[model samples]
Target: MAPKRRRTVDNESKEAVQNRSSMVTRSRSAKYVKISDNNNSPVVVFAHGAGAPSSSEWMIRWKNLLADSLNAVEVVTFDYPYISQRKPPPKAEKLIEFHSDIVKMTAAKYPHHPLILAGKSMGSRVSCMVAAENGIRASAVVCLGYPLKGSKGAIRDEPLLQLTVPTMFVQGTKDGLCSLESLEVVMKKMKAVSKLHVVENGDHSMKIAKKNLELAGISQEEAEQSAVQAIAMFVSQTIGAM
Candidate 1:
């Protein structure tokens, strides 16, 4: 009798199958796309804060700012499954898994370019968890309004400690959700190359008082522009180092 040959499973095909099977059937949250002028530029995958969808005003504005000002970066934003549903938000571990899957899918789609994981609040926390667990290396991570801890709660320090990629935390000086003091302590313990940019008198949503804005002779639009410029500069420097 002739020896029978065994067929090896194709890893790529297997992944595709798993991805398809794991997708949620319901339309939970929305996904938005902003294309950049520079073709083949690096991609910035953004995750929104808890309870907010990708179409939220903040995410839309950030996407536009990055796409228009960054020159060579495309921005993609997606909502977590929990937020996609009208139900309560998922637990942190579940959110992390969702973020990881989104990153993997985004990377697979744009295999030619590097990825930068950028998130706001809870989204940023989830991004950090994904990056650490998968050993995925991004050009950099832009954490906008990172939530170090909730009010009257103990802070989660593991994500910052385990991060190995270049990270920039853009925070408001007066953010109540995550205090500046707590963030400063956490930043000191981060293992990765990290920098913090504090927006003077800004709140948890990075919104400053109208009086201050007027005094600075800057509009809300201008503040957003400044933030985009800062992010672009950080990305440029981090990519250069790589």
Candidate 2:
């Protein structure tokens, strides 16, 4: 007799089976805030950076800003277990599995909606890893304050290199973690279509100097708003292409 194939459901996607019953309940300290102007809009799930909880001022500001700025898209933000537990974050590789679980839960819950994974700094790297490993294609990815290198100046381009989906990277001009010159080199080597937006004089957190903002004839708010808008525009174009 011929060997028989194992049963497969939902078009035989392992991602479907692996996460089918693995829906993650939002932790006690976690929240699922959604912003949607249109029901048909793509779902944008944002993971918090390594150092900050989802409720941190930076995350809160961007959560509200991206939701408001992205307008039509639905944006959801959540905290990592370490952040919720008040402990030091695990190494980057260790967080990918957990991050993937959260993302898979979100995607499964919103099965029909186009999904977009986004993150800040270390979170961005995790997003890319999940997309690459899970076999689930995201419409696009938006990397806010991507940490291209560690504090020790070691390049972290492997995750960026493995991404198969379009990725837009919003980096601060002065961010030591992501040296523009080095990032450009990695981008050139990437097979994925990559776009970069430089936040003039901004740092790791994308904070601009009041002096520089004054010289540029734009308010700090305007500089910040531009960063959000750039990501919004990237989503718009990417969604349009899809």
Candidate 3:
């Protein structure tokens, strides 16, 4: 009998199976958080403020709020070294590399989705700096109560000026750290397109004073909901333009 013919079809099928298995293993190893069941939705990498860890109640609340408002598939939040290691917080510049790494990893896991960098006060400032860095192609940035002033009340406009990506600022009218009037001036100087949503009488944390809430005839939840809605609109417009 002639030499048995090699089973080319079987060999090819076996190779294909191995390739698929490898892909599955890689997928399983990649870390990611799913905020919604929707596929290919935007991914938000949210950083916490210097005073709080990623697990803080405040961070948790806003993370969920952002996911719902932006229709994001994932909202990834990571604690900085200080928060995670119980060390003193470092300068915002010092945290940029680590923050960029998290953003990159999250982007890699959701390669098909748009990336949005967002954060509270100090975190928001850092996010802007990271967004301005090389190789971070964030679709947009959401700055929740951006700290436009330093400890000594000096303007901190460098990061905002450096941003090349569209940005949305949800600022509190009552936030001493970022006066709306001063932000207006800074926004005028910024090179990137920027939008603002003023939270009347809200503090640095977007917390509306109970008295102010009563005066405005709206509940705290309602005010926050309105802010989130504004963010949604900003995100939609930004993505649509892109």
Candidate 4:
């Protein structure tokens, strides 16, 4: 009888250990998200472009820049599951639910702070899709190089047209994916109040040529800094007017 009782106790203890380990694994995975330590409002959830991970140099650089430029309480960024899982990138529409979940989590975490959804290229397009969803209610959206056209030059303006929140676009003058003229036409049809910051001589990633930078008499960092400053101003004015 004693041996049977000991065996039962051992089984229970093993089950308990397994349960604890499972919980710890889940908690650790949740805690692994990328978030800044600053505890302040205007929490910005930035997303990465299709070609890079959240830890890529461009994403990391802009994440810090956004934090400083917006004086945000914190900036949250995450890689899309496809990138992490090494799967092919899906259409922007397919990513709405996943991206919205991240925004929902971040919004819940900082319930009292102003929420801003910003992203790079394809991420920016998805950000617009997520922002246009019914309950997300972001205070504003800042699109960094929004991909407004397909590779074949089909216009993708439906998401932009649906936004109810104030929006700001940081577009490069030379971005082929979103020609300023086409963007202007779409902007005319948009219901949301919108603003644009044009980066002179910049391409899709807002990368200005060295010669152009020299001609403009500003370093690459300086050009980006100017864009960041424009973002800061737009965020400030938009939020203040709200």
Candidate 5:
């Protein structure tokens, strides 16, 4: 018997299909692979922040940048089931289960490609938990704006410390969601290979002040370019070593 051939989607057709498919709504469905070029590149799964959808402006921007700059990598973003609700959000356990299921399904779909897990804020925490609990081996994990504590100042410390994969934490110096001091402490305790990059004057969303941008004559686009460059470099180095 002969082996079955896989169907490959072209860049143009994939874009058209994605645009048309974006209209179909599911009550608790998570969005997947936004702004893809259909290049069938290595997959990078992205998780959105708490209270935000996968199509939020920031996520969309990042996805597009990755598609344009790293055309060989497909960026997939998914919303937590709680964020898709019409009413109150679901409990933490339910949210974790949803994230875990999405990761598993994605990994199965792209079984041969290198899988990278990337997340923002609460989403990053969930990604770390999924990686740890399932014993799943990702090429690398990238965390943007990781939250280290609750709004009321209570500390949460399991995600970073228990990670087994090569992880990179990209944080803003002025981010209010997570304290650099606390994150540093956690990083010091971690057993896995970890690295942190602090964007000077960047806020929780990696937005910088106009004054600073003007002083350096660096536009917001440039800042985003810098971030993408850093992430791409890290991904390349880590994947190469592996």
Candidate 6:
């Protein structure tokens, strides 16, 4: 009887341990994403581009820049499930639902504060889609390198047309996927207030050419810093007007 009781106790203890481990794994995967250490209002929920994860250099840099620059804006970053699972990049259309869910969750978590949906490249497109389709009210949307047209000249202007909220696009002048001309044409049809801040001679990643940097009398780091500063300004002004 004593041996049987000991066996039961051990089993219970092992079960408890397993339960704890499972919880930890779930928590880790849950993306407990809060922007900045302090509680700041008007959180900017940023989504990473198709090519990179939320922890990539570009995402981290922008996250820190927005957090520090805005002072009041907490910049939250998140990863898509496919990226989390280390799977190949899925179609952008397939990703809109997932990204919208995160945005909705973030909005629900902080009900009082306003939200600014911002994303990089493909992520930016996703943000626009969510803002247009889902009824989640974002104060504004910022697209850091909007892919207006695919490399094969396939245009994706529907999302831009559907948005009724104020939007700001920070586009690189030299980006192949989104030529300045193509984006301008699409912007004309958008009813919402929109602004385009051009990054002179920058690529899709907003990396300025070395020659262009020399022309601006700034280093590569300075060029990126300048772009971030511009983004910070746009966020501040947009949020302030609202």
TM-score of 2: 0.81
**Candidate 5 CA-lDDT value:** 0.67
The backbone clash count of each candidate, in order, is 2, 0, 0, 1, 0, 0
Model 1 has a clash total of: 2
- Residue 180 of model 4 has an lDDT of 73
Superposed by TM-score, candidate 6 places the C-alpha of residue 107 at a distance from the truth, in angstroms, of: 1.1
Model 1: residues >4 Å from true position, as ranges?
1-40
Per residue, candidate 6 scores C-alpha lDDT tens digits across 23-137 of 1111101111222334435677899998899999889988876666555445788889998688988878899888888888888888877788889999999898898875789
Ranking by TM-score: 3, 4, 2, 1, 6, 5
- Checking candidate 5 for backbone clashes, the offending pairs are none
Task: Summing lDDT over every window of 10 consecutive residues in candidate 2, give the lowest-scoring window.
Answer: 2-11
Worst 10 residues of 6 by lDDT: 1-10
Candidate 5 lDDT, 188-238, residue by residue in tens: 677666766556577887788988666645566766666665566666666
Model 3 superposed RMSD (Cα): 19.8
**Which residue pairs collide in model 6, if any?**
none
lDDT of 3 by residue, 1-242 (tens): 11111000111133432343331211111112223445436899999998889899999999998888777988999988887588988889999999999999999999888899999988999999999989999999999989888988789999998988888888777898998768766776778878777676789998978777666666666667667766776677677677
Is 2 or 6 the stronger prediction by lDDT?
2
Residue 84 error for model 1, in Å?
3.2
Candidate 3, residue 159: lDDT? 96
Tell me how far the alpha carbon of residue 47 in candidate 1 is from the true structure, in angstroms, after superposition: 0.3
Q: Write the per-residue lDDT of candidate 2 for residues 88-145, one digit (tens) a residue.
A: 9888888877777777777788887778888988888888888787557688888888
User: Predictions ranked by lDDT, top down?
Assistant: 3, 4, 2, 6, 1, 5
The TM-score obtained by model 4 is 0.83
Model 1 clash pairs?
28-84, 29-84
For each candidate, what is the lDDT?
0.68, 0.72, 0.77, 0.77, 0.67, 0.70
The CA lDDT at 122 in model 6 is: 90
